[model samples]
Target: MISKIYSSSSIYFSTDDKIDFFGPKCTREPSYNYKLSGKQDGDGGFWNTFYELDFYIIHNCTNHGAKMRQIRRNTQYAPASALFVEIKPWNSSITNQGQETAEFF
Candidate 1:
């Protein structure tokens, strides 16, 4: 799993000047191969962190093969400082579980 830690000082802004962490355009490319996991961490604790998984498209172009999981931490105390993601599938066989798995930081 790929893990990243963000401090509480980073300034994130949207194209519309709106303040956001994940912003409104955070999503996987459709033409590319990938699948996103669920939102795992939301507890207001020192160990809070966000996690997700991406499954790369295989040679067949119809199935997902290689996969990678990413984890990140909140950089600010904003109420909207939560994890957000979108999953894109190459085909319709892939399904969304809509479940998050949390772990200590």
Candidate 2:
């Protein structure tokens, strides 16, 4: 995914502007964490703490695997861009059922 972003454009983050919260800095190469593209705390932060619930997310866990993703649309900058994601779990087992699972979070 990161490769695709860099291959498509020249908007990669610079060494001086690289985000190092995840690891060593000095991004001589383009990297992606998408989180690094935005603030992670306070106002305007990614997943803005002010309106956490405003960003809707869905997590589905099943016998195959688990998926967690968020969708944001109709924002100030972009007219219509949707961000979706999925995950393949290595190991997982059902811990709750139906309504009980929803209430836990």
Candidate 3:
């Protein structure tokens, strides 16, 4: 299996664990809609902008999936740059559909 990784500060919310992608104070809000990419130990650093469809929250995991919805020409932030990504819990049901269907048969 391929291992994918991501870099992000641990998310802290005042309410339930359910984080809202568009809510106030969210790190992924419009003004802060930027994310970082690349391997953590190597020379991996890049930035990408966010859009309406690039929003999601993952549970029980930190890694997220992203698409380059918008590209920016500026790199003023440099190494401190970040990239917002959409994350969701791995759906076991979706992953095990084949076995589940066989059991039903």
Candidate 4:
């Protein structure tokens, strides 16, 4: 048997214990759009960005299962780096296994 470990802040967990990727202040409907930010703008932190990367790999299967729809770079006041990845609506075989082979790039 194999086990995988995911590193993320516990504060991002939902009430049901799932990862709260979008977080409490999420401003979009359910989709691949991601807004990763820290406690303050220009805090020079990459915590949420790391989680976004994790979710990207997990959802896209090593970047082979989805296409990037849009990406917004972060600024000092708007420190959240936003991204929207588009995937097939009916891809029932998406292997959410990239976490098992996690790598930081």
Candidate 5:
């Protein structure tokens, strides 16, 4: 299936437990517009600029199987940066077959 892309629009994210990609916000989600501001409270973090590069934050709306949408934003957005990615070392002795570290569990 071909999903339409909003290349001219911006993106945002909600870290609040009460918010999501779809739900009450989804209805509020625009069909042809975007919100990209951190000016007002509860506007979600408008970190990334709209349509900057090919960068996008997408999520599958709740109860919408096999469908996904990108997080949208308004005009006043916050500039953000990816600080670092956390990497965890793989423990072969604990996870490998027959290594058997059941006592830790």
Candidate 6:
């Protein structure tokens, strides 16, 4: 996914720009402890920290993916274009399931 984003025409980055693939620094106790001694804190488990970071990455990816889709459609298809593309009512069913899983996590 990071490679795709980097290679995409819609994405641009400067030399000074830094992309932390995992979103940002983990300042939580579990992450700090795990990194320091390869052990998670008793109260704040590593899995919890991992879940938060995963959520952050997923949220950003979803937003950017939607924006890129919209941009591609705008550039490749005109409003007056008579393209015969089949639309499916269940196209979003998978996305809905993913959202439900994310919420459950």
Could you tell me which residue pairs clash in candidate 2? none
- Candidate 6's displacement at residue 72, Å, is 28
Q: 1-105 in candidate 6: lDDT tens per residue?
A: 111011112223412111122222323232221111111122213322221111111221243343211111111211222223221112121111223122211
**What 10-residue stretch in candidate 1 is worst by lDDT?**
14-23
Off by over 4 Å in 5: 1-56, 77-105
Best by TM-score: 5
- Stretches of candidate 3 exceeding 4 Å from the true structure: 14-105
- Stretches of candidate 6 off by over 4 Å are 1-21, 24-38, 43-57, 62-97, 100-105
How much is the lDDT of residue 47 in candidate 6? 26
lDDT of 5: 0.26
Can you give the TM-score per candidate against the true fold? 0.18, 0.16, 0.15, 0.17, 0.20, 0.15
Model 2 segments beyond 4 Å from truth? 1-54, 61-64, 76-105
**What's every prediction's RMSD, in angstroms?**
14.5, 16.8, 16.9, 13.4, 17.6, 21.8
lDDT of 1 by residue, 1-105 (tens): 222223232224411111222212222444333233333333334543422232321111123432322232222342335555443323432222112233212
Which residue pairs overlap in candidate 3's backbone? 34-82, 35-82, 35-83, 35-84, 36-82, 36-83
lDDT of 5 at 62: 39
lDDT of 4 by residue, 35-88 (tens): 332231221264544232122223333236443122222211222353433222
Error (Å) of candidate 3 at residue 73 is 32
lDDT of each: 0.29, 0.23, 0.24, 0.28, 0.26, 0.19
| Local distance difference test, candidate 6 | 0.19
Better of 2 and 3 by lDDT: 3
Q: Rank candidates, TM-score, best first.
A: 5, 1, 4, 2, 3, 6
Which regions in candidate 4 have their CA more than 4 angstroms from the true location? 1-31, 40-94, 100-105
lDDT of 4: 0.28
- Using lDDT as the measure, the top candidate is 1
